[model samples]
Target chain A: MCCESDQPSLTQAGHRRGQIQLLAALSAIVLVWCGLLPALGRTTVLRQRIAFLEARGVNPSAKFFTEQEAGWRNAAEVERQLQEHPQAFWALPWRHR
Target chain B: MSQQSRQVSDDSLAMIAAGLMLAVSLCCTALGSTGGGGAAEAAASAWQNPLSALLKLPKSWESNPFAEVSGWLPGVVGSQLLLGAALVVGMLICRVRTGEFLLPFLKVFLLSVLAYVLAEQKVVKYYGLEYALWALLIGLLISNTVGLSGRLRPAVRTELYMKTGLVLLGAEVLFGKLLALGLPGICVSWVVTPVVLIVTFWFGQRVLKIESAALNMVISADMSVCGVSAAIATAAACRAKKEELTAAVGISLAFTVLMMVVMPPLIQLMGLGPVVGGAWVGGTIDSTGAVGAAGAMLGAEAEKVAVTIKMIQNMLIGVVAFGVAVYWVTYVERTEGTRPDISEIWRRFPRFILGFLGASVLISLLYENLSDGAGFVKAVVDGGTKTMRSWCFCLAFVSIGLETDLRTLSRFLRGGKPLVLYVCGQALNLLLSLLMSLLMFEVVFPEAADVLRK
Candidate 1:
């Protein structure tokens, strides 16, 4: 089964064509089944969730200060105070506080 | 019209099959493009804050493109002429490559099954079937159908396709974030993998006495380290025969599917915490995508833990590949009288892995130097890499399905030893990981555990 045949017939071509059609149909069904349909469902669900959050006035994307962020802020403040009052910074009541 | 005439007919049939396989591959690519592109556009709309958008779209979409595709198909199918046109073009490509249609055709079917299972189970909130399934299937198809009992010339196209896919896969390996698991994650993976490999190899050889060292190693690496991707990397490095590669992939995929379906509920039943559960699942499960799905089923925390753990494991590919290459050359090649030179090592080394590492390193450097600019670029790059990787994997699956014969696969199952080996190894992985996570994190090292909690 390794050689080419002479003068391909209409029937052979038709057979090949039919196979391609079947495959294409199957692929389309799968594409929709696996990809499109579920995506639609998710979009609906997400939209609902977004709407609900908006209604509740809760920003889904709100940024809350993390401990790391707080630490950075604290560090910057300490540095600023140190730059302002080099030696006697530790003596101040506010600095001690 | 005697023997020559019959030979001619056989050739024609083979040609027809080849043509069909090619057609199906083209169609799959087209369908994937349409489905993928439509999803991308919708995801772009969802990408309001590019950095946040990247996190939302690519992570979610990569985890499950079907969900994304479904969301956009309803509204955009009409307005997005490009999607429809792309779909049509994909169909036409399938038509032209009609002879080799069965492989990709089977893949679309398998992908559908996986997608349905994922959605029905809600394994991951938005993820569909694992992309690794597609890759495994394509690898099997190519090795079996196109590469089987054929002249080198006939198989050239398929091999070219396989190599190209591997190269593209390299682009997906982002080096920087791979280190996020820190030294602990890396240490765990490195320690566990070699132990598993050593045990499995010993069992395969001394205990089971399997004739093929190559087969033993391939299966061991696949089962112990990762799945088909690991098998392929190791197989290439070891210069294993095509049959060995095929057998290892087939075995790995079968177990992976079973594990993906079984592990989630098992974890829930065991009442394992997210960190423990994620570590257990990540260490035991063969496929990364499936691990994510299984983790997602547990909870967001579990998903994060599982994915992070698996990412660390995935990063081990480079180390494992290099080690295997060195071992194979020094040990196996020396005894086998096929010692390869340095150039051969370069040739045999799956080059795309370099791309994966390169992309990862570049991303890391960018993130370090330009933290603000890094996120946006990383997002786009991640999206592109994921798309390409998935496509390459899908194509490989199609190739595998076309090449495989069910009878041959069944013949290998006469003895239940391989199955037993896999189960035992996986159980060991679960127990080991669970113990480590519990003792090291929860009790002994609460400080480290706190890092995960955050």
Candidate 2:
């Protein structure tokens, strides 16, 4: 008889579960960013590793092939173009000059 | 309409969007461009293989548009409009609900920004971690935890965003640069990479008997080629699942951090001179920046050689993607004994690959012809497209993460074939690259080593 009664208890289960999951997910992110990452960053191993890379002039942060190589020269070239060409693709309204 | 027919149309429409974007970029690039020395710079940088020639990036994040937001507001607005047309068009055309797409687009844009900021953070960037992983983590967090509501579901168009990103990636594949390093660089990168990739894949399929062919291919390409970029291009070409791509990228990044740190010191200990050491590092390391950084540890010469060889290897992204697309259509999906019909192959083929190739060919032609074409092309790529591609990819990863079931990834990991395949493939790449670098630099054409000094 208890099982037979459609008391909407089962109907609300999905929503209740979703809410709980959301809270857990949020807590995980907060813990990682606020607690875990800060703690990890403060470690000697990570700091020394970062220092090692810096000394070698290696950019460990580069996600793609063209990224490190695509620096400085591009900006210089663009500045040159804006100075030379009356109308350049990059010659928009925003220039430091 | 059948799902198959719908997919064919979907791919075709993506190509159209890419084509439209390319056409607009060419118009902008073609209109006002006149200078010399850019090609001279190109010629010199060819052997050095300056990637700045291929793609544009800010000097640093601090000076880039993101940092100096107000100062560069107009330029930012213009570039975004110019390059983001394909992304916006992609979503709009997929299923027209002009009003509906806006919120979803905003959601995706915000997510991408968040991922980008997280990746760009000093500590994260310094550790060799990247935006794609952050985006994926964020996505997985949302999906496995709170989950996507109906309103958010519309923006999780992984294929569309990924396809557009692939096309942008294609534009950067300047095949003409492959010969810049001569035969030795070609041998180290082109010959060794494909051989290692093929052997690794066969080993996975025949020896290990991995269940998922797509997973095998992603790991192989990511190991052989340039990490996440190769994984992405391959995943799109073969239409691998989100979980498969996520796994492929995760493995690639983990290995890359290990390889980048260990390779330089190992190379130095081995007494492989800058040319050979740099070539070996360039040929082996998964990520581009790490290659440069690793190469620099040897010397300035080694750094140049390393970056140049990697740039040459980077061209393989297009060829391998196209080849994989063809192979998948022809053999992988074939049922038992029957040959795939031409029309069937056409239907099954990933047409976005065609967009990818088209962008490559178009941009290469422009770079070749104009007096100041190199400058003009550089302007186009550097000004906006790279950022757009990065954003699109970040969005795709986020979408993938949202859709993923963590259990599936854990299940795949349980097999352990992927780890074996990566180890074996990387081992082969190391052996062959070392042999080729030594042979080309020391034995056959010793003079090729001199080019590095020049």
**Best candidate, DockQ:** 2
For model 1, how does the per-residue alpha-carbon lDDT over B170-201 read when each residue is reduced to its tens digit?
43344543444444455457677678888888
Please write out the lDDT profile of model 1 over residues A1-97, one tens digit for every residue: 1112121123545655645654665577467656665566567665564344233222211111010122122223333433454432223233444
Off by over 4 Å in 1: A1-97, B1-158, B240-246, B268-271, B335-360, B373-377, B411-414
- List the DockQ of the predictions in order: 0.04, 0.15
Best by lDDT: 2
List candidate 2 stretches off by more than 4 Å.
A1-59, A70-97, B32-97
lDDT of 2 at B186: 68
User: Residues B1-454, candidate 2, lDDT per residue (tens digit)?
Assistant: 4656555655765676666665655554444433345555555222121222333222223212256445434443443454445556754666644466556766766676667666754466665788889889888766665566569877777876788778877777776766556566667888999998999999999999888899999999998988888999998788777778888899988988788789988998898888889889989988877787677667777877787777777889999999999999899989989899999898788888888888888878876785555566665665445656776688789888777767666767786888988888899989998998997777765555654554
Worst 10 residues of 2 chain B by lDDT: B44-53
Task: Give the C-alpha miss distance for residue B321 in model 1, angstroms.
Answer: 2.1
